[model samples]
Target: MILIALLALPALGALLAFLPGRTGRLAATCVAALTFGLSLRLYSTGPGFWYEFDRAWVPALKLRFHLGVDGISWPLIVLTTLLTLLCCLYSLWKTPDNRLIGLLLALQVGLLGVFVALDLVLFFVAFEVVLLPMYAIIAGWGGPKRRHAARKFVLYTLFGSMLLLIGVVLVVNQTGTADLAKPAGTATLAAFVFLALGFAVKAPLWPLHSWLPDAHSEAPTVGSVLLAGVLLKLGTYGLIRVAIPVAPTGAHKAAPVLAGLAVGAILIGGLICLAQTELKRLIAYSSVGHMGFVLLGIATMTATGLQAALIGNLAHGLITGLLFFLVGALKDRTHTGELAELGGLRESSPQLAGLLGFAALASLGLPGLAGFWGEAFAVIAAAQRGWWVAAALAAVGGAIAAAYLLRLLRKVTHGPSTLKLTGPAGYELAAWAPLVVGTVAVGLAPLLVTGVTGPAVDALVEAFTK
Candidate 1:
């Protein structure tokens, strides 16, 4: 019931957001706040599903209207809610378009649904539900190349979706049940491959990642935030929850390949960031590198690796979300994101410069920050699996990450003043403060995330071992 309400509130708000003027915006913000409140009820101690709801939806096909929450999913569900709420609140001042607010809320419903869905078919439906609103968000309100970026984003994802649908169909036909809780009886390697490739495209793993930079560079601020913050999580989450479990034999066989590609993404993404000249595009490329670390953790398929992946997922959501927000604010003020055209941020806006620096440091996986644990543990997990070469390369990737981020700071915040920009707005601070606090909090006590995910990760690893 709580889970239903958690999803329903945003859904209802989305409709209400079509209302006229401030009424719609206020309604959306209130609804978002309420939805965030509802999500809090999902938290619980220990492992396995803390709550579950299942019902038959299609007798003929064995599909069901099933939703469940567990240690592994609770944090993500909460993150989806929190980020949506913050994005909505940020929209109130920055965007103020009722229609945009509506689309954001609509996107929220799909994100929450994905985190809570327990049936593969339902998960796929929730997954696909996100496409149009996001496409609309990017196409309607984005930069000069909006249409091109949106079309590419949709085309790339649609191709991935086709593969995902085939994988889902294959799994369902073989097991005769779409319920993820049930064993995937004799599911083939081909099914896992289809799913992995589909998800990798969304994770926007290197090579398949071309669509991401364009999308992020052209997307509106809120759109970019959601894209980097939680939208990307769907892919990594799908890997953890579906691909590996449903096809363990394939997972074991393909682990090495996944690790290799992940390292490639880490190194390649960082190298690209080092060469990037646009602020938003640079941050966008950084996501490819960061998500690469998360994927590396997943490839190891050990308890340590999975736990690292989970925390890394949450940390990226916090740190990268903040980066996009800050970048958006800077762009809004300077009217440009070009690196050479922007300099001495501290001279014009010390507060914003300080925030950007903090975000940059956190992004670089600085010790005692939210970003540190996941990358460190991912390398450790790879070494644990005796993939020493992959670990060493991933470590180099980390150093490369630090180099690029510091370079970003030097280019944007340390030189002679290029533009006189106003400080961040009150509403902006209101929206950003939580993410800032969350990053620091998680950095200081990773247990806030890890404690919840540990048991669930252990259970999944146990099942995989069997």
Candidate 2:
């Protein structure tokens, strides 16, 4: 029941928020908070274990209305719940229309479903559910190029979803079961490729990533947070949870290719970031580099590597979420992200400047921040596998990380506070503080994430090595 509540509450909230006036934003925010509480309560009742509810939906096909969360799922689940709560709160000051709030809640419900769903069909359905509202948000409310961005986003993602569906079909057909917990067969290379392409598009790996920057730049603040902070993880998560586990031999066969592409994305994304002026676009490219570390982790197929991937996901969410929020604020006041025209933000808004500095430093892989361990440890783990070349490439990625982030910070935070404003408002400060606190807390205490993820990685190592 708690599990159901975790999935259903947002949906109910979305439905009710359709009611006329009467604090629709407040109602939606309360629902998100309540949902987060429910998730915590569920986690507490369990002794660091998966809470699953499975019952036959079709005995003829072995599919079920299955849902569960292990250590791997829990971190992402916590991520989903936490980010959703933040999104709701953040929506308070910039509250759009009540319909928008309801729509955002709908997106949250679907994203939650995607993270915990166990059945392949359930996963796919949940995954697709996130598309419409997001597309609507982008197309309906985005910037000058919103329609194009939304179209690109929808087309690319749907194309990837098709590939993913093909992969699911092959796997289910081969294994006679869609349950994620069961051991996958070793004989499904073709199916694996189908799945990888689909997931990669979301991972937005290299060639498939064209849509992301445009989407992020155009979408509203809450949309960008969830998109960066959660939506993209859907790809990498599916890779680890479904693709690799279902076809180990195929995964091993593709490891080299995946590793190469991961390295390429890092370098290329870094170069692109250096050239980009649009605030959102720069952050979008950084995502390309960040997820490369995740792909490298998966490519190494080692326990430590996998841990790096999981932790990296958390770090990217925190760092990028903050980046988007700040970008949105800047856009609100100055009405432009063109670096050539914008200058001296620190003077204009010391609070935004200070927070941006911390997030930027954290993003550059400063030791104390959440961003450090995932890439650093991923390279270390990769070296142990004699994949030192890839490790070196990852090091280059880090250097590029420094290049782009420093460039962004210099422009956004330095100079002479180009756009002036009254200092941070109460609600604005309230909204911004959680993300700032999150970055610092995770940076200082990396284990809040790594501890939860380590066991899951160990399980993977044991499975693969055996």
Candidate 3:
């Protein structure tokens, strides 16, 4: 019942968000907030899945409405709810059209469903649910190139979806069960390749990532936050949730290739960030690098590596979501995100500048922050797995991450006051403060996340070893 309600609330809110005036917006925000509280409460009711619900949805096809959560999906569920709540709060201050609010709530439905889904068909349905509303969000509410960016996003992800569907068919045909926990015979390498390519495009790894910067740069603030925060996680989450567990043989064979791509993204993404002059695009590219760390963690196929990947996913959601919010706030004030067009922001808006500085540090994997644990542990896991070369490459990528992020801080926040900017607004602070606390809290005490995700990773690793 809790699982069904958790999945249904946002969807119901989507229609309610269309109600007239501020009432609709308030309803939307309340729905998101309530969902967050519910998710947290569900997680807190001891460890493992709380709202266990399974029902036959498509008997002829062997599909069921299977829904549950373990350590792996629990934090991500919390993340999706938290980000949605924050995004709703941020939207309240600006008060976009009621329909946009509705779309956001609708988006939340898909995101929440994806995390808890225990069946592949269910996961795919939830996966595709996210596409339409996001497309509308970008195309309708984005920047000058919003239409182009939105279309590109659809094309790339849609193509990826086709591959994903193919992979799903192969897996289902071979296993005859949609339940993720029930092991199937070793999936063929082609099935794994199809799945990896499909997920990678959404993950936007390396070459497949070209659409992300444009999408991020053009999207509305709420759209960008959700995009970076949750949409991207779907891909990495799929890799962990589906690709590895179902296809261990294929995963083992492909580890080196995945590791290589991870390194490429780390190095290539950093270099690209160094060349980016626009703030949003630069941050978008940084995602490519940060997600690289997550891929590396999974490639190691060790408990520590999986733990690193899970924590990294949470940290990236917190840190990158904060960065996007700050950038959006900065852009709102300056009317531009060009590094040269904005300078000495700290002098004009100390709070914004200070938050930006802290977020930048977190993004760069500064020790004691949330970002450090994942990057540090991923490399350690890689080395322990005897992928020394990949480990060294990841280490180098971390140094470059620091360089690029610091350069961004120096250029945008530290110069002489070049623009007369309104100081941080109350709502802006209200929106950013949680992300700030999360980054620092997770950094200072990584155990907050690791403790919950560790057991799941161990079990996952054991499955892979078998």
Candidate 4:
């Protein structure tokens, strides 16, 4: 029931926000705040428990209100709550519309529900629920090309979701239960292929990532923040939550091809990032590379591999979220995201320069930060599994990461500082600083997240090992 409450607040708020006179923002913000409080309550209440609620809503079909949370998902839920609260507070002063807050809240509801819903039908519904509000947010409030971006985003996502639905139905009919805890080898390989394609599109792995740069480049600051910070995780999270556990034999069988695709995303995304001229689009491409690393971790089909993938997912969320926020701030101030059009910013806004530096370093996996462990673990896991070639390729990917990020930093924050722009405004700092500090803190004390997640990981591994 608590899980359901947490999931419904934002949706309810969205519906209510259409009223007159500041009602939407006020109500939505309060609802977001309450949702965050509820998320925290789940943690202080118990670190390693799943608060569950279920009642048959459709006895004829065996579907129910089934919802739950565990250590594996709890941190993500907390992270979701914290980021949403930050997004809300950040938007207080300058967020565009009363309805915008409602949309933000709606995105949060969909996101939190994605992490918690246990039934396949329920999960897919929540997963697709995210699409509309997001599409509306981008097209309604984003850059000049908002319509183009939104159309591309929706069309691609719809196609993927349809394929995902097909995969889920095929699996459910064969396996007899949507509970991912149940093993999933009964489905034909065709179903697994559809499922993998559905997810890979969202992960935007390699060739399927074409829509991302447009969405990121065109989205509003808050939209970009949520898109990168939380939304991108949905596909990967689905794979982890549903694909792997539910179809272990299939997942294992598909590991090599998946790993190959991951490596391709890494090298290709890295090369493309090296060539990007728009700051937001560049960040989007880097996500392609970063997600590639996460997939590589998952492909190892080992305990360490799964752990690396999980950590990578969380760290990528934090780092990319911060980066998108900074990009938005820059865009707001300079009225541009084209790299060549802008010169150095360090002299102009020392604060902006410094924050970008920190975020870039973290994104590149600077040691002792949130980004380091996931990449490091991936390399180690790959090597340990005798995927020495893939490990070497990942190392090369890291080097490529360094090249693009360092070059980007040099272009934007170093060399000239000639933009003469003002420093990060109070509100922008308010939104960005926490991300920087949190990224660093998580980097230094990775165990804070890893510790909470370990037991759950052990349980997941038991399926394959035991």
Cα error, candidate 1, residue 131 (Å): 0.2
Writing each residue's lDDT as its tens digit, candidate 1 over 231-291 gives 9999999999999888898888999999999999999999999999999999999999999
Clashing pairs in 3: 369-443
The lDDT of each candidate is 0.92, 0.83, 0.89, 0.83
Q: Report the lDDT of model 4 for residue 317.
A: 83
Arranged by TM-score with the best first, the candidates are: 1, 3, 2, 4
Q: Report the lDDT tens digits of candidate 4 across residue range 364-426.
A: 999988888988898898899888899999889988999999999989986675566777778
Instruction: Give the C-alpha miss distance for residue 219 in model 3, angstroms.
Output: 0.1
lDDT at position 195, candidate 1: 93
- Candidate 2, which segments miss by more than 4 Å at Cα? 44-49
Tens-digit lDDT track of model 2 for 1-466: 6788898899988987777785777888789889888777655322224688888877887779888877787778877877877877777667647777787888888888887888888899999999998898788768888899999999999999999988888988888778776655554889889989999998888868888988998888878888999999999999888888888889889998998898888889888999998887888889999998889888888888888899899888888888888788878888888887777877887877787788788888999888898899889988998988889988988998998889888887777764775566677667667777877787788778767667766776677666
Of candidate 2, the 10-residue stretch with the lowest lDDT total is 41-50
> How well is each residue in 88-115 modelled by candidate 3, as lDDT tens digits?
8888877568888889989999998889
Ranked by TM-score, the better of candidates 3 and 4 is 3
